[model samples]
Target: MGILSRILNRRADPPRQTRMLEGASGKRWPSTPAFGATGSEVLAGAAQVRGRARHLRFNDPTAANAAEILRTALVGYGATLTSGAEETDSAFADWAAAVHLGELEGEIIDSLATDGEALIILRTDDRGALRLQHVPAEQLDESYTVELGGGRYIAAGIEYDADDQPIAYHFRPARPTDQYQTFRAPIRVVAADVLHLFRRQGAGQTRGLSWFAPVILPLNELSQLQDALQVTAKIQAMMCGFLIDQNGGATSPLGDGESPLDVSLEPGTMRVLPSGWDVRFTTPQQMAQSVELVAVSLRQIAAGLQMPEFLLSGDMRGVNYSSARTALIQFRR
Candidate 1:
């Protein structure tokens, strides 16, 4: 009896120890723990940063340009829905058309490009017409949760079953853009009534990362450099030259060869130097290498977004027909 009990206890032993990550608060935990209600083990403090990136994609010029290019390229041609003899009539197509006004696919694709997901609410308005509203992912209450019969859950505004199927989505009762009437509870909608579209990268992945997430930092740096170059050029253009009396000569206002002596560097104004002073005009060096450097960064961004360089930069200087066709073919595929 003692030997049999020892064998049973040994069989019930837990698994061996594994590597762990130390949090900023000095708490050590496993990198991949068992699934919990919130599942914070995998995506600890990621949503806020992703939300900021979505905002930047709208305000940042480079991100906006890339997103726009993607939207136009991916959904420009539009798609056709075919029905067979056994299928129903054109009512479905007509209803979709009425809902989207000929830009259904484009809108959905735009949402994916910007937010990495799209929420579509299907309903009928007062006029009995099918109204399809595209809701921003930010509107979903990621922190909201409720206890029900099945088990405790981490709502994150979306409920999924064991098989990773979406069961329901909880939306904030108030519109994000609305400024008034702040008191409202969350509204839950079944999965059948709404379409939540996203590209899942893994078996248990739930949240979506913005398409611009990877290249955001690089794009912002590039934009800042370009802006600095423009500002430098503008300042150089606004001022012609400086009158300097390097030899400790007369410190009075100087005149140019043709114009009167002046101290200001305003537009259309030329300065003349004293006899002992010299007028030194800055020779602006051509940023011949900047074009190449900017192109390289853009290429990286394009690669990250799975976009072609020519499409984002609109540069065809060195692109021949063969190369352009090949690139387009690959991008299309």
Candidate 2:
């Protein structure tokens, strides 16, 4: 049986009768100790009164002698000479009990506030010393994050493809709106700083993309810059998909193409693609201009990626590409 069940059974049973010594010659038994008295107090009291006389007869000429005899009789009847000592011991026990009760009540109050349950157990150490121990509640779910950094290139986002391979993307240019005018420049590597930011957003599940229109630069200017720099650069720009993964990692570099989404060549003006579609812009350029273009291209590229209808209609901070696309499509329809 479980411990609680056994305890309940014991409490349900009737109290057992205790045997007491009885005889005409025996001294009167003292009243039983109060409820909740410690075992120490009960034992001490019994020892103190084991052999003491209550009164002495003085009329007898041999009263002193008789008193001594009565004392002996009291001893035979279970009286002792340590009544004062027993009283002091019982008072000490009472004080200890009061302190213990207060501590127990305080623990109960604390547990209630925290939705916790306490388990009390008795333990014995190697030295045979007995102690009472309290165990606290445990949490079933816990989470944490880790950050990793490398050089001046801060990781803008890390994405897992359909196959679950991690693709890390870095941006030299900062901010989503930076792509407005200069869409054809190669991003500056010197300006890039890599940082790994992690978080526990929710359960292990991929979230839907939030779309935004990215401005794409023209290809003519991009080719000329690539020729001048004598670098093999493929300038491409498109809306990209992004989301916070279950592990709180930011996912990006979305869309199909040779170049990462939201990047450009030095000379071409960036172009904005159709909403709710993922696109790619590839370019190779020397200098910090390419990095700057990458930062500014996110707006148009993200707008081109497909996303859930609810998210597109939801009240978000940036403009909703889905709504804009729907309006344009309605006019065409």
Candidate 3:
């Protein structure tokens, strides 16, 4: 009777609810970051963001200018490394010259500008000489992570110890086509042998956001609007006037039955019209505001990128020597 009573008193699991957290506005939001997205889902979104940022470097003028500004400030002439030990400094200098570290450093800076992160692999060649290889951040196997006994987690290629300190990196080797290929087992290396440079914003953030990520959407829309304005202006200039006959049954400009006239206008060209025919010109609104609009958009983008507006647009109109110098100094800071 005791055993039967114990079995009968056991409880079953409750049913799951669709609603999660309720905000002040009385709206329910999913109880998860990235809208309840899994780690793999977040990684997929990150991959798309990285690809868009890379393409914007070539396709978007504002992005190109921002990249150049960052490159110049961070590593225009390359960074110099100094060591307290004379012997170590001299030996490293020799190795740097052999590997063209000056040039490679500039490339690394460019990568950071476009991709938001750069990976450097410190390796020893067959002859025992140290070699450095640059790998894209996307190639890091974010899926190859583990959770330790404590509250620490390893998401992506990085492995953190119990104290949340990075201890190792897992990398998928590059393929012959220079594309990222998943390996059966990623190459695991100690954190000391790899340098992962990036700007971290949020606490516990695993990846960096692109430098131009903030202004990308607005800048792209502005660029498209400017292009449309320019095309409209050109079309208005080409179409001067249209000829229309007031009298009925007028002969068409093209020889025989009611054909439309095909004509090209040149600077010094002349055309003769019939007696009852008149040429009416179209008057489009003056687009002087367009110039100001473009300038304002450029200024906003430049401010976001921490660069001088004139430098981004290549226009020095109304900017005197003193103002230019002042802007440059402030931007440097």
TM values, all candidates: 0.73, 0.14, 0.75
lDDT of 1 at 248: 85
How does residue 50 of candidate 1 score in lDDT?
62
lDDT of each: 0.71, 0.33, 0.76
Clashing pairs in 1: 254-272, 255-272, 255-273, 256-271, 256-272
lDDT assessment of candidate 1: 0.71
Please identify which of the two predictions, 2 or 3, would achieve the higher TM-score against the true structure: 3
lDDT of 1 by residue, 204-243 (tens): 5566656776787888788887888889889988777777
Ranking by lDDT: 3, 1, 2
Q: What is the lDDT of residue 127 in candidate 1?
A: 88
**Per-residue CA lDDT of candidate 3, range 1-333, in tens?**
699897887778657766444542233435543333333444556666677878878888777877887777666565555878888888888888988898888789888877778899998989999999888787678677677667666678888887878888888777767544545678888899999987775556666556666667767778798889989899888888887878866665543554465655678977776677778886767677878888899889888777888888889888898989998877766
Task: Show where candidate 3 strays beyond 4 Å.
Answer: 1-45, 81-90, 148-152, 179-184, 244-259, 264-278, 282-286
Cα RMSDs of all predictions?
A: 9.9, 43.3, 9.8
Higher-ranked by lDDT: 1 or 2:
1
